[model samples]
Target: MGISRKKIYEEIADLIMQDIKDGVLNPGDQLPSITRMAEHYQVSSASIREALNTLSVMDVIEVKHGQGSYIKERMPLGFEHEFQIITRKDIENLLDLRKIIEVGCVELACSHADEEDLGRMQDALGKMRTAVMNNELGEQADYEFHMAIAQSTGNQMLVDLLGDVSEKMLETMKETRRIWLYEEKKSIQKIFDEHQAIYRAIAEKDSGNATGAMMRHLEEVATVLLKQHK
Candidate 1:
């Protein structure tokens, strides 16, 4: 079942609270930039804004003008533990499902994508490059570029399926990114290269290359999470 929009906002709020309770975030600590939070939460800026606002209304955080949102000295009531929603097995399942859908979608996109689709993907890649330059994880741009490939497939069912599971996928993506970027100490250029390969293959209308690229990306994701699970 698809998650409701309101529930997504609440979930984002809970993720932040979990970080706080774990002592990963401290009072007076400025939260990650809104863009970073939106990527990590797999929500839009508006949704993140609403989530932040919800925290503010509950007096859990303070949003100061001319500055970003800050953790407040006082936490809302009953935030003693993390609100975990899924297990490692669940994340592995999602990556497997994504591989099945996305690999096929890329094959279709190779034949169906037009110049406009290519342009959208190019723009997303540009954003990714900029994110890397700024020492950001570029998760949102990475999602959008893959989404552009799905969009190019011109199959509403494929598109709908991806959208339905995207929320769950976003959560796993955060974990995967954290491992590769921070825990594993991997170079960010590897991520950029993988994405660039996918884009170039699609741009060249090469289904074989696109399928292989998609598989490589998804396989790495699944492998990382599975390793973490073990």
Candidate 2:
């Protein structure tokens, strides 16, 4: 049988992980750009992004907005077992729930967000735009953007609820975002544009538009990711 794309990416992730272990890629070292890595590995940019996504989620790397991927300051002590347990089904379920929760969050933000809240969202989006311009992944800024919206609700319970799931949600975000950005062949600019649209709606206090934009962003990521899994 032909090699599956999933297996190919997993192997690429493993190779990078091994490089870390062998001191070839030391802690805090910035990795080559996805384009360069793809050229070296003779793989597609999507595969490189998948490998980086897995590493980021595993705590083996940190993807900083406006900068490239870096080896973590401290590697995860025990991530292999946990990583193995997270199936595509788990991500799909989480995306379904994220759509429900975050769309509501954005609607509330549109209704109640203050200037400070809008400023925070705008800051996150700015970082995301810079990351895109530099050909970097804006995973952390993406999380902050959504969290800022949740905080704008002025509902502590909702904020706490999302904070409780922050770890898993982070991993889910990295996966879904990479799939949408690279696997779906969507541009990084598109990701920033989608978030910008949501921010604009909230800034204008348009609850209907805010929720609709948020839903579309989440659903597009989910749709592309699930389609790849199939």
Candidate 3:
């Protein structure tokens, strides 16, 4: 029964990919409503959602919390192999890398961030607030906030490095947020607050506080995510 259910969702994912290839769904196109797709595919909503999640993790679709999922600008190369091999350990390693990179980033930002940098981070916060109100994941805004911190460091090399792996970072955020929201039953407001704390510490130019906040935020997410695998 489990094997059959998994096959169904994978078939649905393949069908959606075919639609994209056929130009039935174009880049930046919002997918049909889940309910609509469920009825059309004669599958449960859970199965439809699983298919969408699979595509989203594969970088084939972008899932917004309140907004519907949309086709990505480009499909990832070698996604099938990635879908097969992605594991909890991969997520754990990613979270560890973030702790190493981002905690130091916020500390540097406390020293170098100008008003313009703060403005960008604040702008991201505002967008996150709107997303929370709308009951969305706010993943894009969350990504922007972290990028803004990297930018605030005035380190072009670091910015470029993060940009190169931006796709993976965004995917990690989506996965952890899903775990936090759906699996852990966390409130969106609480999640937003973690980012807010990091922002506040940087804005205040307190390196000690900024690093602590960033570390805590990443660690909290890591604990929640890793716990699930156990």
lDDT of 2 by residue, 184-212 (tens): 46777888999999999999999999999
Task: Please write out the lDDT profile of model 3 over residues 30-144, one tens digit for every residue.
Answer: 9999999988888889988988886775567999999999998765432222233345677678787788888878989999999999999999999999978976678899999
Q: State the lDDT of candidate 1 residue by residue for 49-128, as single tens digits.
A: 97787677545689999889999864432332344465666776788789899999999988999999999899889998
- TM-score for each candidate, following the candidate numbering: 0.65, 0.65, 0.64
Query: Looking at candidate 3, what is the lDDT of residue 53?
Result: 83
Q: Kindly report which residue pairs in candidate 2 clash with one another.
A: none
Q: What is candidate 1's CA lDDT for residue 16?
A: 81
Sequence-dependent TM-score of model 2 = 0.65
CA lDDT of each candidate? 0.77, 0.78, 0.79
Q: What is residue 44's positional error in candidate 3, in angstroms?
A: 16
Model 1 CA lDDT for position 94: 82
Stretch of 10 with least lDDT, candidate 1: 75-84
Which candidate has the highest lDDT of all? 3
Per-residue lDDT, model 3, residue 196, is 94
Off by over 4 Å in 2: 1-83, 228-230
